[model samples]
Target: MPDPTFAGRTVVVTGAGTGIGRATALAFAGQGATTVVVCGRRKERLEEVAAEHPAIVPVVADVATATGARALADEVRARGEGLDVLVHNAGVFRFSPLAALAPDTVREVLDTNLLGPLLVTGELLPALLARRGNIVLVSSRAGHNPGPGSSVYAASKAGVHSLTRSWAAELAVHGVRVNAVAPGYVRTEAYRANGMTDRQVEGLFDAVAGSVPLGRVADTDDITPWITRLADPAASLVTGQVITVDGGMDTGAGQTDQDA
Candidate 1:
């Protein structure tokens, strides 16, 4: 039977053009979220996903900027419905050595990965509080399990993890639940876009799969269900937790230290 946990609910997923964000948006729609706003910087990609899923409403916005984040929240407000779920999934990861890190790049990464979601959450807090909604921040295992050359990226996600706990505690009185999902390496276009050659990508995937206790790297789909579950009202009592969906990579036996 199709799950109706999200029936009549409105869900917003940032960076839903591709990867886990897209997968999470689709999953919510499939489970009967009446309105699924899929926001991303890539207009074409967002449009394509929206075309494939009638329930998806595409918004081409850069959540990396304060203006863009406010605009997105305004668009959601204009829908005239209280939000039921907000997935802060938009983020960026750059693996530059500390010496090579430019100030602009670091600022951009921090703003996009951390500050943007905080802004959007603030903007939508009213709607979410009215509905006692759920917020799912897509964090990274890198926050706690940082590897070589992941200082800034790890810091950004660590901040997200901290925010998740703080928001969960603060919003609990308002009945708004906050949580995070930290996934290990997942196969996505990000690898290619980040300048990894196809052969290198494959090699990295192989290495990751070998290292993971599950003996495989995850795809976007593999990570979506957990996110959806957290957003579901059925998990109303669950909050202030960071659920690691890394296929046992966090265990001492396996350590897949790649961005999800």
Candidate 2:
């Protein structure tokens, strides 16, 4: 049986259809959270997850827009008295060289990755404040260490990290804690769907692993538990921290050797 640490709490996880988001929703549900609001753009996938766990409340909404965020907040307010945990996990990654990057593409990436979380957090702030809740923003190792083709994605995540610190300070007075988790490359279906061949994906993983001291990529399951722990009331004192769950990929020593 799963632990009952979150037996009576209500948690919200955006992008709960797949990858890290799906794993996170399951983790919270397994912990016996009374209401796990799972938001995603895909109705079928969200319903599939919700079906697996009745405690999961699937909400199909594009959280990248202001209207969508307000709708989600309204729905949660209507169902649960208030929200105790908000996981802003919806994000998109795109690859483009600096010279070839289009203005529209950058805007789209920023809107989805950075502004989406801001809007969602803003809409839910009142409820979260009332409950002294916690917010976990899923950033990426790319934020701290940028590569050649992911300029926009890196910028967006860096914004998330900054927001995490800023909000943690801003909300501390209300007893709300905010933090970010930066994950390295994790195996997800999205990569394959995006036209990455198996060999290419494996090669990318191998390259990333070689750069990390731990020499491996993280699994979605591996990161979910830490997120759950951070959201717990026991971690009340931990805020404004960017916890890099990236297998030491962001450490300068390994990259320094590579560059040398």
Candidate 3:
């Protein structure tokens, strides 16, 4: 049976173009969220996901600029007076070693990955506050332990992690809960999006799959449930927590296959 935990709530998911954002939007709809606004950089991608469910609403809004953030906030305001949940999943993770990083690329990464959440959340704070809502940030396990050639991306996500903790403490007084989901080694377009060729992507996947305790890369399915549950009333007392969904990745290595 489908969960009805979100029967009357409205959810806004940014970066709904492809993987996790797309999956999370659909999951909430399945769980009976009354409205699921799927905002992304691409009109067609968002529409494609929206077509799958009546509750999913598509809106093209870039999270890389204040103008984009304001537009999304306005869109939400037009639909209702309050927003029950806000998912900041919009981010850019183009990889570049420091020497290869261009000024513009750095700006784009910082703007989208770090500033976007702050701008979007600030614009929608009143609406969220009105409902005593929740905010779920999609950070990266790399934020805590950055991988090679991903310094900027890792730093940006680290900023997000810091925001998750700080905002939780700050928003607690107003009854708005803030939490983060830090996903590790998920097999998604992100590798290709990071400018890796298919061969490189496959190679990375093979390597990551080998290192993870579960011995496989994660699908979007592995990550969305924690997101939905965090926003649900069942986790009402949970806030300021960063749930790492990484197939036992964050746990340091020691156990062999036989130990499992």
Task: Indicate which candidate wins on lDDT.
Answer: 1
Q: Ten residues in a row with the worst lDDT in model 2?
A: 251-260
- Candidate 1 residue 110 Cα shift, in angstroms, is 0.3
| Alpha-carbon runs more than 4 Å astray in model 1 | 255-260
Name the best candidate (by TM-score): 1
Candidate 1 per-residue C-alpha lDDT over 13-58 given as tens digits, one digit per residue, 9 for 90 to 100: 9999998898998899999889999899989999988987788999
What TM-score, over all chains together, does every model reach?
0.96, 0.94, 0.95
How well does candidate 1 match the true structure, expressed as C-alpha RMSD?
Answer: 1.3
Expressed as tens digits, the lDDT of each residue in 65-140 for candidate 3 is 8888988988899998589999999877776777898988889889998999999999999999999999999999
Q: TM-score winner between 2 and 3, please give it.
A: 3
In angstroms, how far off is 154's CA in candidate 2?
0.8
- On lDDT, the stronger of 1 and 3 is 1
The alpha-carbon RMSD values of the candidates against the true structure, listed in the order shown, are: 1.3, 2.4, 3.4
Q: Could you give me the TM-score of model 3 versus the true structure?
A: 0.95
Q: Candidate 2's C-alpha lDDT? A: 0.85
lDDT of 2 by residue, 85-198 (tens): 999998887766789999988988899899999899989988898889899999987888777778898899989999999999999999999988888778776567547798
